[model samples]
Target: MADRDSLIADFLSRTAWAGARRAPLAGDASNRRYERLTDPATGRTAVLMDAPPVKGEDVRPFVRIAQFLRGAGLSAPEIFAEDTVYGFLLLEDLGDDLFARVLERRPDLENSLYEAGIDVLAALHAVDPPDLPSYDPALMSELAALAFDKYRSGVVGDANDGIRAEFVARFRQLLEHAATPERPVLIQRDYHAENLLWLPERSGPARVGLLDFQDAMLGHPAYDLVSLLQDARRDVPPAIETAMIDRFVTRTGADRAAFLPAYAVLGAQRNLRILGVFARLGMEHGKPHYVDLIPRVWRLLQHDLDHPALDPVATLLRAALPEPTPDNLQRLKRQ
Candidate 1:
C-alpha cells in the first residue's frame, strides 16, 4: 500500500497539477482502479488510471487504443501523462455524462444516445482494425462453455459426461457457423451503454466517448453491435434495437441475411458467457448481485436461440441446463 501511494504521488508530482485533489471513481470488473484528480489552482480535472501490473493488469493496450481512437477522430480520453512501470495514467476527464447515467436522467434522449452509439460502431467497423487476437469459433466456444462449467454445474449440479460432450460439439458448430464472417472488423469487446459516454455537443461518431476498450479484438462486426443492443444490465427498447439494426445494415451495406444470423449466434455466445461470469462473481467472489442479472441474461439468450440457425445448439442447451425459474435463480443466488 505504501509503495502504491508513493508511486501515485511521484507520478502526480511530475505533472503540472502537482497537488491535485483526488477522489475515487467507479471501477469496472477488472483489477484496474480510477481516481478523479482536480487541479486546485486551475480547477481542471483528469482521470488517474491505476492499473497495477502485479495484478495482471497492463496499461499498454489502453494507451495504444486511446491513441488509435483519437487518431481516427473518435472521443477516446486524451493521455496527459503515463507511468508505464507502475501502470498509472493521467487522462483528460471525459466528464460524468455516461450514456447510462444520461438515460436514467432523461429518458427522452434514449433514442438519440443509442443511435449515436450505433453510428460509432458503424464508423469503427468501416476501418481496418489494429492487429489483435481473432475471436474465432474455437475461442468463442471455449468462452461460451463457461456457462455450463460454472453456472449450470454450480446451480443444478453436474451433468452426465455424455450429455456434456454432446453439448460441447453442438455449441462449437454454432459458433463456427456464426464467427466465420466475410468481413471481420475491430470489435470493442465491451461496447455497451455503461462503457459509452454521451458527448452530444460533439459531432458524428465523436458524439459518443469510448471507454473500457482494452480488450478490443478482430471479429465479426456484428459482435460489438450485439454487445450494445443486447445489454444484460439495462433494457434497451425493442423498437430502438430493431431500428438501430436496420440503420447499421443500411449504412454499412451489410447483407441482412448474413448479418442477422451472425448477430444471433454472437448474442447467444456473449449472453452465455455472461451467465457464467455472473455466477462466478457471486459464488467465487462474494458479489451476489450479479446473480440477480442471470434471469435477464437467460431471457436474452432465449431470444437469440429463437433464430432458426441456432436451433441445434439451443435444443442442446435447453435440454442440458434447467430453466432459469424463480427456484433456479434462488439456487444460483445461494451458491
Candidate 2:
C-alpha cells in the first residue's frame, strides 16, 4: 500500500496537473483502480488509471488500443500522459454518461444509442485490424468450459472430471467447425452498454465513447456483437437486439444466414464464460455481488443455446450445468 501510494504520488508530480485533487472512481472486475483528478485552480478533470504490475495488470495494451481507436476516428479517451513502467496513465475524462446510465435517464434513446455503437463496429471492421493474438476456436472453447469447471462445480458439488472432459471435447469440435470465420477482425472482448458512453455532441461513430478494451483480440466479427447484445450487466430488449443485429449485417454486407448461426455460437461461448466468471468472482474473489447477476446470465445463455447451430453441445451443457436457481445461487455465494 505504501509503495503504490508513493508511486502514484511520483507519477502525478511529473504531470501537468501536479496538485490535482483525486477522487476514487468505481473500478471494474480487474485488479486496476481509477481516480478522477481535478485541477484545483481550473476545475479541469482527467482520469488516472492505477494498474499495479504485481497484481497482473498492464497499461501498455490500453495505451496501444486507445491510440488505435482514436486514429480510426472513434472516441477512445485521449492519453494526456503515461508511465508505462509504473502502470499509470493520465487520461482525458470522457464524462459519466455511460450507456446504461443514459438509458436509465432517457429510455427512449435506446435505439439510437445502440445504433451508434453498431456503426462504430461497422467502421472498425472495414479497416485492417491491428496485430494481436487470435481468439481462436481452441482458446474460446477452453474459456467456455469455465461454465462447467467453475460455475457448475461451485453451485453443485465438484463436477465429475469425466463429464467435464467429455463436454470440453464436444464443445471444442462444435466451435472449430461452426464458429471459425474465414477472416478474423479486432474484437473488444468486453464491448457492452456499461463500457460505452453517450457523447451526443460528437458526430457519427465518435458519439459512442469506448472503454475497457485493453484485452482486445482478433476474433470473429460476431464476437463483439454478442458481447454488446447478450450483456450480463443489464437487460436489452429483444426488439433492440434483433434490430441491431440486422443493422450490423446489412451495414457489413454479410450473408444473414451465415452470420446468424455464428452470432448464436459466439453468444453461447461468451455467456458461458460469463457464467463461470461471475461465479468465480463470488466464490473465490470475495465479490459475492456478482453472484446476484447469475440468473440473468443464465437466461442469456439459454437464449443463445436455442439456436439450432448450438445443438451439438447444447444438450450436454443443459444436463451438466445446474440452473442458477435461488438455492443454487445461494450455494455459490456461501462458497
lDDT of each: 0.87, 0.92
Candidate 2 has which clashing residue pairs, if any?
none
Q: Residue-wise lDDT of candidate 1 within 1-335, one digit each (tens)?
A: 55988989989899976788999999987789999999888899999999999999899999998998888889999999998989999998999898899999999998899889888888887887788888888888878888888888877787456776776787788777765878778888899889999887899999999999988888988999999999989998999989999999988999998889989999999998998898888787778788888888999999999999798888778887777787777777676
Residue 328's lDDT in candidate 1: 77
In candidate 1 the C-alpha lDDT for residue 107 amounts to: 99
**Which numbered prediction scores highest in TM-score against the true structure?**
2
lDDT value for candidate 1? 0.87
lDDT of 2 by residue, 78-193 (tens): 99999988899999999999999999999999999999999999999988889999998889888988898889999877867887788778878888877788888999999999
